[model samples]
Target: MVLSDLGRRINAAVSDLSRAPNLDEKAFDSMIKEICAALLSADVNVKLVGNLRKSIREQVKFKDLPPNTNNNTKRRLIQQAVFDHLTHLVDPHAEPYKPKKGKSNVIMFVGLQGAGKTTTCTKLARYYQTRGFKACLVCADTFRAGAYDQLKQNATKAKIPYYGSLTETDPAVVAAAGVARFRKEKFEIIIVDTSGRHQQEADLFAEMVQVQTAIKPDQTIMVLDGTIGQAVESQSTAFKQTADFGAIIITKTDGGAAGGGAISAVAATHTPIIFLGTGEHMMDLERFEPKAFISRLLGYGDMSGLIDHIQSITRDSAAMKETQKHLAEGIFTLRDMKEQITNIMKMGPLSKVAGMIPGLGGMMGGMSDADGTEKLKRMIYIYDSMTAKELESDGKILVEQPTRMTRIAHGSGTSVREVEELLTQHKVMAGIAKNMGQNKQNMQRAQKMMQGPNSKQQAAAMQKRLQSMGGAGRGMPGMGGDLSQMMQMMGQGGGGMPNMAQMQQMMSQMGGGGLGGLGNMFGGGGGGGRGRGR
Candidate 1:
């Protein structure tokens, strides 16, 4: 039920305006009220929301109407205007790999502890290698224990050359050696994996400046944890002010609600995110596409980049293509759902996946915050409790049995109510999938809007939206357009796994029918309280 908070705001505004037959003064005023409320609740900056409201008012009042204009036209125009305002906030310059030809690249990874800097380096190297560049890894983190060993291990896996000095205490020397070796080896790209920071590490940044000078790198990338929402902007600024960052890599995307904040950070730093590390694997990387990303935030469709990553690793085009066909056709079953979840687990955590989408988070606004994340952990526990047959079979048992529901509730430390909620959500999603099959245009338009320049700007607007919402945005993909389309797709088990909606459904039904009720009974309601659903 995670929808983009921003998208929901826009939709709410439209819905309010649509309630009236014409753009009367009162209707316009009411619409503005809804817009202001939704934006503010989304954590958007108050001043920004105010300015947008003013523009909306002007468009409705002062602007000239076209010949034969009606309330519908007015409403649509207002929708577009609001969308434009939101879009303007996304920072498009954050996309990194749209490189200039013949420009040697120097990218560096920086983030807090446990942010997966070492793994990011290998993924970045693999990214460059795929682009036909000879890449080198610089283990400049001579201080952090096991930092050097970790980078080297991933480098070996990628089969890319690397340089690090075990004896030298000076990281500068190690950086210099790595650079010199890179040049000698004719490497077109060099990635420096610095030690993880303890927030605003001035000395470390100074050292990074020196390393950048030694290499004169064309691009400097700040690696960020997907789970570090509000902290991402400040941390990125610290690095940018020191080393002048060129792009970003939002890593550990399979982790938490950090994806929303990470996207918001892109606008704050005025730099494009070049890549996203969906998993720890070398191939779990993708070029940052604002539209695709925004569409995901809104719960529009399966991520093409995610699919591409899977295809690269699986090398089973036929299976993938067939799966997609089945998904689009709404032919999914519990068996398909199990396979989908297994693959997604292999890729990374569910929360990270949820934040990448657009409107779904808004719907899920009630569940997430800057400091806490329990969505993914809950999902893992629920799924762990399922037997293979249970995962593959639908309506076999516990679909309506209170005793079974109680058992599941106890087993998962969740509630029977929560288990039922999950089932209800799944039913809703299956309906969306069926609807998506019928309304191809809305889905396509949503997809296009998400991948285009609008998405980049909307992401920027999201940062501004953050202050309004109070909690950072979190949710699943594709929530606004046609719920039934999403539901049908879920039934077919799209790209990553059974859609989050289906997962919720299956988990709920299973829990309610068996020991799954334990989760809700103990934890009070499982994760069913994710958001305030309409």
Candidate 2:
């Protein structure tokens, strides 16, 4: 089974347990057996399969339950046990060395030729650069003819500092020169990309060793191709034995059916996986969080991961802040709508974003099939069809004038109904943004510590501030008056946004898909989007 299918199978196994009328040994054992099969089929090691299965069964059998032990509690225990074991199987519990700013920290990359070593190096550099670290790249792969050119192109595009030479044939010479140059230039994180032979050639290995010894890098990361599956174990071991690799990165996971196998294989080697390359884009790299990965894998959303990805995009902190301020007062313009859509696009595909959420992870593939992206593309064109004045103020002109909507549809080659749908969607998003802004501001105030005479005084002061802030809390966006209510709504599945089906119906009644994604992306968090370059 593919990794995606494996997750469904595992989830189905658990879901079956949850639906059982009685938590009898027969049913529980059946669930365990099904899960074991799914994991083993996904290229997870046999030993891990056996261990997790035994552990889950033992926990259930040995549990200290009262005479009236309920099925819900029993099911939860089994689920938790399974979640914990899977996490343990992945995390090596080893902390890799992190580069501190203002000092040169060299990191070396080693892997087979097709493991995407060069691109991974660029992604790593981009990751650090966006996070305020001065990072540069060095191409030391003299074995490959285009290695230097590829690195140069990637670095130039990302605007990251790079050092390499066309005439340098020896990788060690290039490595030494690149390291010295970047260090002199005060680059904090310097990454050196080494060559990877097709079949682990002895000469290439010796060259890698030579480069490593010459550079004396702070960390040596082994890049493993997830498509190779069980072979990753031997490859990981070889790299570790060669250079004492500090971490591992699994690439091509976006296309690799054996991604799970590679992860499990690396775990068996006791090497910590630092990241997963989820797609072809430079920003497709994601930091590996065991709980988040497992949560998403088992059909639970990784809300934290989703939030972080949203934050990474959405440039212009001041503009975002201004937008939020205006939105809090229930003000949203067509231009603001454009900005939000652009930010979402920058964050990548909608399905990828959906997979990061807790409830939507399981339906990622289906969501992709829902033609939501085509709808989004239409929305973007509709946005592009708007005039400057139409975008600046409220969309009152477009709403008041049907001719304008018709003009937009004609211009964008879309139906007039789509334009109206986009408008109505904007209204819903504005409402949510307003609530989110107010709620976030109120919450920040509540979380503050006041210098007061007593606890009662502070409590009264907080209440007064909340009251002053208009604690109406009805349809409040983001984290507001009742977190439980928001979670309850989320559990009902619209991802705390207005139900998509209902939104579509509303759109059909008047004519909206652009703003539906906005609520889930920013409505809950109301991030300041501070500490980033605007």
Candidate 3:
């Protein structure tokens, strides 16, 4: 079973138990049985699955629950147990070494051949570089022909500085030379890519040791292929004994059916998984957080991950600042919407971003990245075709002047209906902005309360509010109702911004109409006229 299939099976089991008319111990056991079966099919270790099953049974204690307990309370306990146990299955409880800003941090990569160590080196370098670190890569894989060239190519494409020597035959010598040169130049993060073997060969271990000795690296990471499944446990254990790597990065997770097995196997050895290479793109590396990973796997979404991605890609552009100012003032213009759409494009694949939203991921259904991108392009085109005055307005002017809509549609090569759809989407977001603006005083008070002596109480109250709003199956199809509720919550000083549930609902609305209107315009079927551009 693939990761998505495994998640679906497990989620279905839980949902089935939640909806069971009896909600008895028998139903709980049945759910556990189904989850274990799903995990086993995904190549997770039998011993690990058994332990999980036992842990869940112990945690829930369904038989001991008070007879007076409501079904909702029982469901929450069971769900929490499954979530916590799954998180524990992947968490090593060991913190990986973090590089200091001013100091040189040498990170060495080691793994079996074809585990994607070379490409991952560039991805890691780019990750640190984007975070204000002067990061570089050094190729020390003398065993593999063209290893240096591959690293050179990847580095060049990512625009990261790299060091490699075709003339050097000694891996350790090349590694030491690269580290010395970068350290002298004050590079903050120096990542060394080492050679891998077909198996855990003696020669490979010896070479890894030599490179480790030469660089005295602050951290050594073992890159594992997620497709290898249960075999990763033995492979990782052998490498741990020989190379003593401090962290692990599982690559090829995006398509691996045994990704769950790989993660659980690595965790069994007590090494932290620093990242998961989700795709071939340099930007596909995801920071590993156990809770977030399991949440996303179970289709619960990862709000923190979404926030981090937003923060990572968000720039201090004048346009963005102006939009933020407008949002604060309860004003959202077409220009503001354009800036946001552009940012969404930068956030990465629509599928990935949609997955981060609690309910929107599944709602995306069959929309491909190409389709989503094309739709967004059309929206941008519509904006571009507009006059400067129209762009700056709150979309009311275009609504009042129906001819302006027809003109924009013709100029952008889209139908007038698409233009109207864009305006409708703008209206939704504008209403959100207006509500936010009206609750500016409440937001200020809430911020002050968070900083005050009773901050903990205020924070708890706010969390309670979010939890109440985040009930399962609450938003989807009828996003406007949810958006209104979210705005009302904000107005009541429940943390001025939308919570994860609200954001999911808002995204659903956007996906359904604003961002999602592509289906209608392109004849995929949402009841809007087809575009001329099509």
Q: How well does each candidate superpose onto the true structure, as a TM-score?
A: 0.54, 0.83, 0.86
293, model 1: CA deviation in Å?
A: 2.9
Per-residue CA lDDT of candidate 1, range 1-534, in tens?
Answer: 212455555565666676776676677777778766765554444565677788767766634676577776676566555545544545454446543335446666666778787888888788767666778799989878888888888899889888898899787777877877776766778788777665556777677777777766666778877765556667777777777777887777654342455655666678887777776568778776554454343344334555555555445435445545655765433334434444544554433443442222333444433212344344444545555665544423558555765665566666566656555444444444444454444445444544566754643454344324431222122333233334344332122222334434434443422212322222334543333211
Give per-candidate clash totals: 104, 6, 0
> What clash pairs does model 3 have?
none
TM-score of 3: 0.86
Which residue pairs clash in candidate 2? Answer: 301-357, 301-358, 420-511, 421-511, 421-512, 478-524
What are the RMSDs of all candidates, in order? 12.7, 7.6, 5.5
As a whole number from 0 to 100, the lDDT of residue 274 in candidate 2 is: 86
Worst 10 residues of 2 by lDDT: 525-534
Each model's C-alpha lDDT? 0.58, 0.71, 0.78
lDDT of residue 32 for candidate 1: 75
Alpha-carbon runs more than 4 Å astray in model 1: 1-68, 92-104, 112-114, 130-134, 157-160, 198-200, 226-231, 252-264, 277-286, 302-534
Off by over 4 Å in 3: 316-322, 365-371, 437-453, 458-534
- Give the better candidate number (1 or 2) by lDDT: 2
Per-residue lDDT tens digits for candidate 2, residues 1-534, read 236677788889988988899887899889989988988877787887898888877767734677688887777777777777777778788887878988999999998888999999999999888777899999998888898899999999888888888897999999999999988998999999999853367788788889999999999998988777777777777777777888888888777385667767567678788888877789988888776677777766565676667666543366666676677676778878877676666766675676665434332335452355555566777778788888886778988988998887777767776677667667766666665665665545444423234534654566566656666444343332333233332332123222223323322322112223443322222112121121
Ranking by lDDT: 3, 2, 1
